[model samples]
Target: MKLKPTIFVFAIWATGLCHAYASTSHEIECPTEISAAALAINAPEGWSAYAQEGLRLRSAEPALGPPEEKAFLKPGSTKSIKGGSIDSWLELSGSGPTGKWIVCRYGERGEITLSKKLHDNTSACTVSSRREQVQVSCTW
Candidate 1:
């Protein structure tokens, strides 16, 4: 998929492209605890794992070929394979189910540590953003 950069124009003063605002950084967080099963059931069809956290769907059978690349639009997402580098995407390992799943490492300095898998029974989640921070709040 082609990525498009979002540019914000503030003012123009007859000096070419005057002022443009672009967000350089982003933060991904799910304030309310959630579970893999709950995520699989609750998340929308095209939900981003980066935005939802641990919401991966896998088939009972193994994948036929190599893993695919999953892009996370938000910040703090890591690169594929040896996922230490911070990026907006990840290379998912194995074959996911009908839905999309991004499996990559991102635990490094400045990255938020994911909480242990637990049960929450959350049926819906609301995502909000302010500046660079992305918040995901869930409810039953």
Candidate 2:
């Protein structure tokens, strides 16, 4: 079988486009003070949970607990990006300066939704709605 020149060119272009889209970066712009480690879900909640769900992730299982992966987070950057997971919600929960707690959500489609300042002891961040804005709850 012989492929036409135009067809071949389109095919190459499409392949390149696909690769770019697949590797596209989803970035979250947080203040410089936030460290990569602090911008993610911590232990006793998201950590243990993600370890448990790692199997589910490999088997295409549903999300079992708080979000673990960076999804599309920038390397060594705590921007709390999205678009890594195809269908699941992940979180970033931590206590900020002076124990100001915060939680963020990294959705299945690579969407990052950071919660308002929460209680320092909050262990997880779950999504909800309040005052027509994306509200997140810190629990456990």
Candidate 3:
């Protein structure tokens, strides 16, 4: 019984240590530029523009969490993400016509792009355009 308590304490300590390591200054070589556009440009038929109040792009990799920079997309406008760095995933969230939704996409590191498509049960986010830097356009 005493041994069990000791083991449990060790486990907690180990978990904390892992979290600490994840937040340390670990350099991850990745693209430093990003851009996000919120519009109905390439949205599917019947789909319309909706405000993405909580649009954000951030690192999905645990080790890159702290160094994980984020870019926010305006609620109902199109603009470039000036200073943000992300690795692994891009998150898009907000209330749409149907309801509230949050979407995640695995990023393409080599190509410096997000996965081709983003969708929920009733709506989808498509890549409207891509240019000099990593540009993303979504409609829902």
Candidate 4:
């Protein structure tokens, strides 16, 4: 009976300690040489753009939690914004506490399409425009 109390106390302490170190907050800076068009594209609804040595994109949605991985093109890096294709990687960080986040890159082609597989659900997006103006919308 006495052991039960002691075990409960230890378990609570261990859980608290784990939660304390679960997530970290840091400021990400953006590169200065990014193209005007890239700069103009509004970050996803809940992301913030920062200007640091390297362009770092931070998420502002506390509910979605911190990002596991972030993706962005380096300044002066020219990617083919045509044929509805892009070469990008979804960066990940944090552990299971932070749900998975995705990076969808699309070209500035006519009605570009972007799709991602999240677990069993596949999400699709489209970017319609080729000039400096690009628009993107995603659907699950």
Which lDDT tens digits does candidate 3 get at residues 61-98?
21111122333232332333345432222333333343
Ten contiguous residues with the weakest lDDT in model 3: 59-68
Off by over 4 Å in 3: 1-3, 23-130, 135-140
For every candidate, C-alpha RMSD to the true structure in Å:
17.8, 18.2, 15.4, 16.4
Any idea what lDDT model 3 has?
Answer: 0.34
After superposition, which runs of candidate 2 have C-alpha atoms over 4 Å from their true positions? 23-140
Report the lDDT of model 2 for residue 37.
Answer: 47
For candidate 3, give the lDDT of residue 62: 19
TM-score of 3: 0.20
Predicted structure 1, TM vs. truth: 0.21
Please write out the lDDT profile of model 4 over residues 9-85, one tens digit for every residue: 99999999998755432221122123334544467988986533322221111112223333322222124666432
Task: Give the whole-model CA lDDT for all candidates, comma-separated.
Answer: 0.29, 0.35, 0.34, 0.34
**Residue pairs with backbone overlap in model 3:** none
C-alpha-based local distance difference test score of model 4: 0.34
- Give a tens-digit lDDT track for model 1, residues 17-135: 43232212222243333344444345578875534453221111111222232232243243333312323322222232333221222222213223322112222222343333334
Against the hidden reference, what TM-scores do the models get?
A: 0.21, 0.22, 0.20, 0.21
